[model samples]
Target: MSGIVIVGAGECGVRAAFALREHGYKGSVALLSEEMHLPYERPPLSKQCLPAHKPIRPKADYQQAGIELCLRTRIEALDLAGHRLLGRDGSSRIYDKLLLATGARARLFPGMEGAATLRTFDDACRIFERLRAGARLAIIGGGFIGLELAAAARAMDVQVTVIEAASRLMARGVPAEIAAIVEARHRAEGVDLRLGMQVAALVAGGVEIADGSTVAADIVVAGTGATPNTELAEKAGLAVGNGIMVDSRFRTSAPDVFAAGDCCSMPYRGDWLRLESWRVAQEQGAHAAAAMLGAVGEWTTVPWFWSDQYDLGLQVAGWAAAEAKTTIRHLSDDAAVAFQHDDEGRLICAAGVGRGNRVAKDIRLAEMLILREARPPADQLADPTFNLKSLLKAA
Candidate 1:
């Protein structure tokens, strides 16, 4: 069976497999997963998959598509010269082309045996068991995953105390204004947010702080961050920097080997950037499949991500620099939209927070402007009376 061998079974790997068939590729496809379960989406793990234990698709679905699903299989060595992949259990497979969709893994705290990180479905199940009513949860990060889990715990009637090293929540992703809004929302939802705090050590009951303070919690979870799974690529002598370095076509330095998703970093805006969003992963996967079929085109889609907390929805499209000129538009007393532009006045990113429908509309307009790199006056953008939909016509 020599065709395409995808090294991972995450969203990117699964999408690549389906995309190959869609693109009229008659070659065989094998999706290898180190886990026993079928390929599943990770976003639901922090949102609803824990409460509702379900698989994204049944095993029969893959079989019907003529894709081989190799479960609980690990590719220990990559013989790039021979186009062969050696497995740990003395199994080997030859691939005409290889796609490295090996996604990232959660960062675990040292000596924190009881603390868990939500990366896999199994991890979500364990975390769900611990999130009982009246149970105290101490989260040790303020990123999206940590805050989302906090909201989920609060919904379950579990007391949550978030310990963040940064002064604001999601400092790396959201701007100051958005972070303030999110922090306020969490506080109103009865989430005890401990900002500018560091966990010196994790004890049985809770965690010890840097200032000789201790918070008692029934369970502790760390959502610090994720590290790219690039060990296999590095071992195969591929160009590894921050992640497996790939070009705009998802082609790696090694011939006939392509990488996508969180495992690969591509050149963007004169810098190497690795996006961990599910949408980007799927898009890159499809693009990679097209490139593998000799239909190469540089990926040019704008990146966007969304989060749901309590009753509010937040959406951001494209990248916003810290020094970028910003404009704000208010849809209501509590709901607002914002746009960021570079010094040259080109729209770089847009963010909105509001009810589902309103935010979705605003985000769509902003995404259009970003895709076009449109430069509109800051005042005109901030005016709520202005019709943002008109930008699409102008573009």
Candidate 2:
């Protein structure tokens, strides 16, 4: 049976089914996910949903998809050479094509017996139980996940301390200058930020620091990094880098087999970037489905990502050139925009915080600029005389 099988129920797997049907791919589709519950959104697990004791999923979203869901089942192994998969029940099924959308898991608080993570539904429940007011919370990483949790814990009147091995917050995502703003804001909220502090060991009691200072806490969390669930493909001898390598078409090393979302590293232009963002997952899932449906297309959408924290909504669009002499404009006390250009003086990235619709406008423009022309820096672009609508059209 020329059926398609998806090995996960996460955004990538579910969205691929939706996109396939929406684009007129009617082959048999089945999704195998280990989680017994419906696919829930993970973005808010660290913020709104976790603190409110709410499920991150909305029921209405998936009820109409009519996608076959196999819950409470884990994939035991993948026999790529035979074009089949072995499930937890020792059952095997042959497939004409397959997609692996296995997402990442939480970076655990290593060696801590009672250490908790906020990745899955179970993790959320486990972590929330320890969020009582006056309870001490020790976070091992100061990235977005850790900082967002810090914000939530602070709002709940809990004592939160984030130990970052790096000097800046979200060092991987945000520029150093941008990270400084967040650091200052977190300090104002009374979040204990041990910058440049390394956690030497995780014990049943608490974390042991390199400086010999022990951080005692009821809950210990790690937001250090997420390792992608790519064991099946790797064991099958598929090429793997930071993730399973795939072309713009989303096909991996094995023909009749594909990968998407965070599990797949895809090429964009000349760059081989692996984005772990939700938007990327949705877009790539659709592309993979399209390819299965005999649609020839490249996944070359401008990258867009957003993060919502306490009174701060950060949105990034396109790629920011680090060395590009750029301009910045403070749109308001709580809002700002930056225009990044290349050495040849062409705009490459349009980034903003708060009032980020400007970046969105550029994205929606039909004739996208290749950034070969010189435009005024951010300050001039923010001037009242500069009509955003015209620039949006020009873009």
Candidate 3:
């Protein structure tokens, strides 16, 4: 049948299907997934949903929306000329328009039999079950995933040890000053933090460091980042970089075929940037669907991501310039917000951490200032007495 065929029924696929309907497209939508479960969220895989699984949308909901759920279906290859997708089981289907949202996969350590990586519901369940009381959990790659899993493990009374190759936690995502706060918080909660270390081998007990130290872990988990699933796109002869390259309108190199989510890199700041974030995936999916419907729209939302570890919550809005000047505003002993400004003192990004709603107001204000490209004096930004909301009046 000739209709819209969406491969990989994750957040991007599901959102794109609904977005098509929203954009007034009355056509058949087929959502295909290699996994058997319904479309779901991935961020919760390392957090609360690990203990209790939650479906993204009910089966009945999909039916009501006229979205055909093709479970356990794998598209082995694509025939661009014929608009046919060859399946692994020898099944074939034609599409009027195709949306590739294959997403990404965990970058695993080769020959590591005991270590596990969290990317799907099944992976999360297995990790949760293995995190028993007094169990030694060793996590490699001190990124957000590793640190978040460490928090979850510690909550279950498991002895947590985080081994990061970098000098600080979440080196790529957070600033050095913010990294120190995260390290301090995790350490205070009894997490064994190993920084500036490399895993030479994964033994039975745990991973062996290059420095000849072995971390004793009954269960070893690696959060060593992910790689985009762009093989199918590449086989179809689409231009691929870090991900499938798309224009500001989310169109791939081929005609009648588009890409989105983690698998596709959209235009950002004069270059192509792929964001593996839930929020970005959803937005791009919707925007891509809209573009497929002949709507003129660009994916230009400010990148936002957050992490909740223990009682502290960290939220970041906008992109952080590498050489930006940073200023800190402390609200209390357990709460503070950091702002990064460009050379011209324009607000580029802001990060905040606190127990509850202490940072909420600042986070909202920062997001607004970033969108407005507001430039405030470094002295005013660092002064706790200076009202951040006052900028809105002149904004």
lDDT of each: 0.87, 0.74, 0.85
Write the residue-wise lDDT of candidate 1 on 265-331 in tens digits.
Answer: 9998677888888888999999999999988689888888888777778888887577777788878
* 2 or 3, greater by lDDT: 3
Q: How big is the RMSD of model 2?
A: 3.3
TM-score to native of every candidate shown: 0.96, 0.88, 0.95
List where candidate 1 sits over 4 angstroms from the true fold: 109-114
In terms of TM-score, the best-performing candidate is 1
Ordered list by TM-score, greatest first: 1, 3, 2
Clashing residue pairs found in predicted model 1: none
lDDT computed for candidate 2: 0.74
Question: Relative to the unseen true structure, what is the C-alpha lDDT of residue 357 in candidate 2, on a scale of 0 to 100?
Answer: 49
RMSD of each: 1.5, 3.3, 1.8
**Model 2 worst lDDT run, 10 consecutive residues:** 363-372
Comparison by TM-score, 1 against 3, better one: 1
The best-first sequence of candidates by lDDT reads 1, 3, 2
